[model samples]
Target chain A: MGRLSDRAAFEQYAAQAEQRWETLWSGDRWVISVGISECSIAKGALETYRHLELLLSDGHIPAVLRRVGCAGWCFAEPFVEIKLPGQPPIVYGWVTTDRVPDLLDALRRGELRPEWALGVRAGESWQGIPALRDHPFLRSQRRLLLEQAGIIDPESIDDYIATGGYRAFLKALFEMTPEEVVNEVKTSNLRGRGGAGFPTGIKWESGRRTPAWPKYVVVNSHEGEPNVFKDRRLLETNPHLVLEGLLIGCYALETPHGYNYIGGEHALALRRFQKAVEQAYELGLLGDNILGSGFSCHVRVRTGGGAYICGEGSALMYAIMGQRGQPRTKPPRSVEEGLWKRPTVLNNTETFASIPAIIRNGGSWYAALGTKESTGTKLVTMQGPVRYLGVAEIELGMPMRQLIFEVFGGLRDGYRFKGVQTGGVSAGPLREEELDVPVDFDALTPLGAMLGSGGFVVFDDTVCAVDFARYLVAFSRYESCGKCTPCRLGTPALVEILDRIRHGFGRPEDLDVIQYASKHIIDLSLCGLGQVAPMPLLGMLERFREEFIEHITERRCRAGVCPMTAAAPIAS
Target chain B: MEPTKSGQRVDLEPLRRVLEERFRPRDYREAQELVVGACQEAQRLFGWVPPEAAQLIAEHLGVTTNRIYGLLTFYADFRTEPPGRHFLWICHGAACYVAGAGRLVEFLQERYGITGQGTTPDGALTVHVFNGCLGVCDLAPFAQLDHHEYVGRLNLERLQALIAELQGEAQTEAADGSTE
Candidate 1:
């Protein structure tokens, strides 16, 4: 291959070095990348890794074992991928330690066991085996944000570079003016994936136009929303991408300081991101005078003390500033006054992660991929009772029916679909009839639902709507920051009524009180946490009024989830 | 409110020394930046922030002790009372809850005889501290022992096995310490 003469020899040298290293590690020898996720660990995946490594070190196998992050198809974790010379890499799932010998035997014989094989990766289908893209779990997904997940060595910057990473950041820095980059994003119509569906371009423009010096760009990587692990996945599996996006955002907004506030509970993700930050700094992609473009930026990777309100923009800023993570009163929005009262731009983990790709492929190209209103793919976590429960990246506006049935392979076992709590705990539940609704921000908004961070938690026939609603309300009550009266008092009051109804002590007026409280909480709460807290309960009441009535009149919970219905009364 | 083994109140001098070395703040507002940091340091040292820690930090920052306590109580990760040797954080996120994290929480509470989201009676474990989301929804019903290690796709049986394993480890460590 002739080297392109347009670039300097050093660029070519770096590219060749990375290519040679990848080929040496992957192409000629057995390269085994095992998926290291918490799910896999629960299934004794670390033991399996140790066994494999032991075998390799003992000269029983000629292979390399690299620990990678989540494969996303989590139902079949303890996932392993093996690359043999002159052959496509083969992925296998549910790899127990006992199966290690069999796997190694297959590798030695140049044959794959079809029983454990998920599939060869796309464009590399060996024999008659289907491609990974053709797998039933993955077929409907349009994986944009999750493009390199489970396929690359997340720790290796060279591996990421070999797969065409960081080009977008370089292009943004050298080629495009800050205004042009902002306009391109605006033209792309990329909305904030961190709920509210605010246009990213407009948010950036606001930060840019704000007449404040030392503007800050913050990444909200705290995935505290219930059932939402997509941000953690991105941070752990492809941290460099998130870093690149942050760098690109800084370049666009002309901000010199950036902070990635990660959840403290996520130790692995935090460590991975910390390492990626160090790598970026070492590469001169971060720190002062980044890439010698006269544009300098430094990113601080801070960990949150596990407050859900810290996911809120203003609260996140306060947490970064080492204060109590209570929501700030608006009018001076985060864009105008944030992070020590500077003009700061805050975006979610997935939103910032999507920036690099948006810069790489032109704004219009990304805009054309998804629906007109919701332009771009969204990474959604489909957990609870699904056959293949994990995160999937789907083009925005894909029907909920298609996602539930086609992508997730429907609910596990014989469990009939009861309902789903889309977005986070805050968003209302959608019934079986509402499954046809497009999983878009605007479309779900009118239904009193939102695509908030794309947590699609499916419920089965065994789930009691009352118990589930009580659980969500209780969660909100417990997690409320209590800065304002509505959230502090209102959430506890809502929980009390919900708890009373679940305990079969509901007065009919309690329902009205709940409804009244829901409206007022939404109206009076100062922050998004308190505002959206009532939606789940309200949604459950609206859709499953019979469930509430059954609990009240019949004093029977069909799903057998409520304690009072199942047992005798406690001393009250 | 816990007393020392020698039948005296636990000394705050060592803790004060550590805090002084780690963070010597000049003023109250300036110390706001070290609120989370100080709490983390306290957690690392004592496994939880005692009332004395609040007082010490408040004094160091030139703020009211209530302010330090307010910040500590606001963040969920900070524990006030001393925990058992191990902290068990179960994610009751929508997915994990639906995948039986509720059952796990119930089972631990019932089996270990713990209540009110605190340490077990024997101080072997803290059973009922629920986390927001472990961010590993792919592994539903995720559980974390201590603050670092993750155990996912947890059922009661697996949780039982993990707890037993932790108890065993703690026993071994105790034995080693006593011998020393």
Candidate 2:
């Protein structure tokens, strides 16, 4: 009964943290955790948390209330997890302030009622609630990056240490050479998760090989993509995991300086990450002679000014340098000449987050998870009208249909399954029949369905193909940085053409003009942003030509989305 | 608010202190790197970059006033002109588009009497079509109120209520700044 009194002591730092974790979860006291990321906070998570804390703060229930990161369950947000002594945790969703007292009362009575609970997680079912592994949304996902989300107090370095966070970095720092670390990542075959799918190991190898001193590591945490939120979620929930991964990268490259370029809009994430960095510094995990290993690494958090282009490699560096966040033409590609024209290791937040797991287990162990070409699990955020909408980590080779139908429970009751916008809004929509295709970057790119950042914006059948394509083209036109002529001019031209077609002014020859201009923009644009801008228009033109033809010839939007009657776009 | 000429005055004492304390640069080239950060800090303090404030930053950073002006003009985050007291941003990304943000945009434009980015005639509120996705598509058809609080699951009715609420707020916050 005295679980707290039976502490097994250890001298190692990670082992000491493990002991702390064991004591916390060893049924010494009841635990209450609330999801507190931006999404949940918007839905009154703070109010619910405050109410619950007030109720339990007196210690009358022998319970402790903790603030943890969100579990990517946006639909049922303001969720609260209650765990009794010797019982698995039960997550109650849609928990308002009014429900806090009732939940506390139930916990106080020593009988957790599961009628309002989402699921239970202790590797088995408890009460009437299903185990998390068996839950439909979680069943298909093998969560690695999000393994500790919602369970650990993200602001607490102790919780991170208990979960074996820096063991991988410690291993890399003490045992392995920088070459071995790069080789392990290369062996893991981890590609960039930030849309491009570049081989991360190869980039690391180059960063390692570049004969430059004072090498820098910049983790691009700026999520400028239209619909991707996985990076923010990672930063919020498992920031230490990403931090540990960053340390591994820095140690591998012998880098002394690191910068986390975060989006300014992500205030909560930035605050939490800044706190994590602070805690690590205090614990001797960061800064000179970390844990007395004679190796020093310092990480500073930098903020972006909400520029979409700043998420690009070169543009991100420029933004770090406090510029206008514009991209430059490549050739000295970041590895060779980056960050003040010095050799730099630039990778996405998710790419760095995957390092610890690869190093902890072998690189081959990480490689065995997904398809031969696209190995390792990917963090995918599904948006739109899906019933089970949220961010999730899924193995790379899973067919898109399983995620759409089986994992997410198809569209909501009234909506029909339309095409899924693979990658972000920048990539083209995959046809309904194309759902059978694997989500591998190479497998889908040939069909113009690159899994850019793994954000799938699913649309319902009610949306018109032409109008939707026109909107995507218009967004590209709006976000074009204007460094080059083709993207700056071509996006506007395509938008004008598409807008004309939607507004019943398109000529038959406009299609040919769009094709020619789109091809030129793809070929002539300076950066990847320009090259990818016309993808939706090009993809829609190829797959949904009939829809455009209908819009042009019959002057009709079959889905009733556009005016199609010579009416202005802003008509009330 | 932007500096209105012939002229309403803005004190540069506080900004000068900030530049000295936080943004003291080593050289001319490194000072160029501080352009965005300086402008960002200035925008936070004043809500929008006043030309005098830009000039002060220019002289402090040892760069030309035009350089700071170029940065302020280029980034979406910076606004050269004065902003309304209350800001309403509609998400214009793909998810919001599918969720009927365009309808909200049209309604907002018609009601506010401006498109793209503009303040109301009464100077109570500013409505801007946010350039990128605010990344909370879970609440598709969302808007950020004054930058942090998100008003999601929005319809025309809720947006009207919000605008009316903000206008009421600004009405109390008059030109003389008597209301606390």
Candidate 3:
């Protein structure tokens, strides 16, 4: 099923694609899938996959092996799935190279080694192993963006077209008006997933309202902030969904062009998204007069030069414009005067990807899912000492305590949970007391932690707050766009103070100095980068003040992680 | 002077392929839309964005050389100088930091005498402590070897072993060269 030339052509293609998808998914042959995700490759998934490929194709073990994207099962990577004709897909974790033959032998015998099995997809049990629905980590998650990640073959356009991927864009183009689509998104109450929780519909409407000749839509896949892996992974998992969403937004706004501003480090994702773009054009899902509509769409994939500041709206536009990625103050948001002063609607990979779901199920259906203010599920990446160190999509109102303890299976048995740095590097490692707070976009701000990009790195007993604070502060200083005086000057000054404190040369008055500097940096800063530059330090100081005091007065490293020397204040 | 590190004249021929193939911006507006791609291709063709390549980009796009150099300096991905034979990106993301990336970093500095962002003495490797998560936090406290291969669950011993292996490979290469 190639290009849908017209409405009838699209319908025929959709029906055939659905049938093809069904045949492929629940087909007669035994299908073996290994994820080609970065996380999977890191854990030696390729080697296992190669071994499996040889084993499956050798004719002794009759099966087919294909590559898929990471299913967000970080704790158990190199996981393999075996799907028989009648049975559900059986997922087994820790499928190392040596274990491939053993797994095949067991599969041949029509038995699953319950020890190796994580769960069974599409069914309740594979002999003894439980269903994925009953999975400990997966139970809480309302996965909209990551729903088809592990199951679908990310590199295949056929898999996407089969699994109800581009239907929303097609529907929007053929069935609904631009106004209706925009209204649906507005009704869904979907806020921007890329840090700033601005209403996505509002951002789009602003772009639509502007009489700019040519408007642009951006899928900000620049997962620049430290600890945020969701955007890149989402793109890698299913680039088509993101593209479809982008096209939908374009259709809603009647725009011609869209840009996928992918990070430089995310080479695999860039390639996949670029591939998806090519496939879309070939299928006529993208390009001029989609299903014979006047709305012509062309997506350009722009690889970032790895600036964290470019993730900022103005800086991103500036970077795209061949200008320095320095932020000019925003009265004219990207939707007003963006990308060479044209109206541009920029949303993150998560936000754009979620658009399909919102459009498919009307706006009210989405609005009813999450909190009153913060609607819809969020793609959150959990890292550090958590048992399941991966990404999971959770509802907005889910508590931090539940996310870390229940969903992620808490830290390791021996370690005590100290804190968790939610959002980004600028946000906190929130203390144990602050764990009960909801992971809402609006609610997390007051606690000095926002659901910014939805990546929360938990800190166990081993982490020394002062040292961690210093690392984060120094990182901010390093990444500071020299455009702002506060971030440029203040971050380095804060780093110095933290460094002094870490090295055991800190004076008692150093705390006051940090407080004063932090105030100026937070208050005087231009963009979010400068405003939140001192946040990690401030959050650390608020929660773990004793650690700092101990480092200062006693010259003691309580965690024994720091090199605290009882010396005079280090000269700047 | 070191061949790769020194400010010697490079062959500008390969840069033309990257420019022609990757970009085809019709006008200045189109060029403006594709600045990042142009710079990225320029960097990829040459190991780093040399002054010559920057000049070419500026000329091609009808922009100032300052703009190109500004981008090269601003983004952490681009380097003005040519990098070492191999790139070692040690992730210092929050996950890695909590999992003792500091210790591994200290170990590299102490054991191999690697300092800051500079290349090793023999020019075999250069250490890049990445500003953020490289999206492989599953393997925390990890270092990406040669940009693709990930050395997971990294510790002092594993790091030492990895260094020995690289050195062994280098010695083999050197011996092969001598034979040739």
Best by TM-score: 3
Candidate 3 Cα outliers beyond 4 Å, as residue runs:
A568-572, B1-9, B107-116
**Candidate 2 lDDT over residue span B104-148, tens digit each:** 887876776666678888877778887677767778898888877
Model 3 TM-score, all chains together? 0.96
Residues A1-572, model 3: lDDT tens digits: 46667878877877887897777777778888887788888888999998887766667755678888888888888898889778788888999889988988887888778899889885566578899878888888888888898888888887887888888887888889999999999999999999889999888888889997688888888888878888788878899999999999888888888888888899889999999999889888888887777768999888778778889988988887777788889787778888878888899888999999999999999999889999999988888878887888898899989988888888877888888887787677688888889988888888888788888888887889999898888888888889879889999899888877878888899999999999999999999888988888888898899999999889987898887755654564
Candidate 2 residue-wise lDDT, A361-393, digit = tens: 999999999999899999888878888878888
RMSD of each: 4.0, 3.9, 2.1
Q: What does candidate 1's lDDT look like per residue over A1-572, in tens digits?
A: 23222324326645875777676656666788898865667677798899889889976556677888786887787888887777777889999899998888876886678778899875756676778888988888898778888877678776677778878988888899999889888988999988878999999999999999889999989878777888888887889999889999999989888889888777778888898888777766778776557888888777888788889888888888777888878979989999889999999988888888888889999899889999999998887788887888999899999999999999878888999887787778999998899988889978877799898789986889998888888888888888899989998899888888888888788889999989999999999888899999998898889999999888888898777642456444
Candidates ranked by lDDT: 3, 2, 1
Q: What is the number of residue pairs that collide in model 2?
A: 1
lDDT of 3 by residue, B41-152 (tens): 7667666777888888788777888878877778888878787666788888888888999888777777666544666666666777788888788778888987778887
Interface RMSD of 2: 1.9
Model 1: lDDT of residue B161: 88
Model 2: residue A501 alpha-carbon error in angstroms: 1.1
Error of 1 at A487 (Å): 1.3
Q: Which residue ranges in model 1 land beyond 4 Å of their true spot?
A: A1-10, A565-572, B1-34, B50-68, B103-116, B148-180
The residue pairs found clashing in candidate 2 are A195-A453
The fnat scores of all predictions, in order, read 0.74, 0.60, 0.87
Q: What is the lDDT of residue B91 in candidate 3?
A: 88
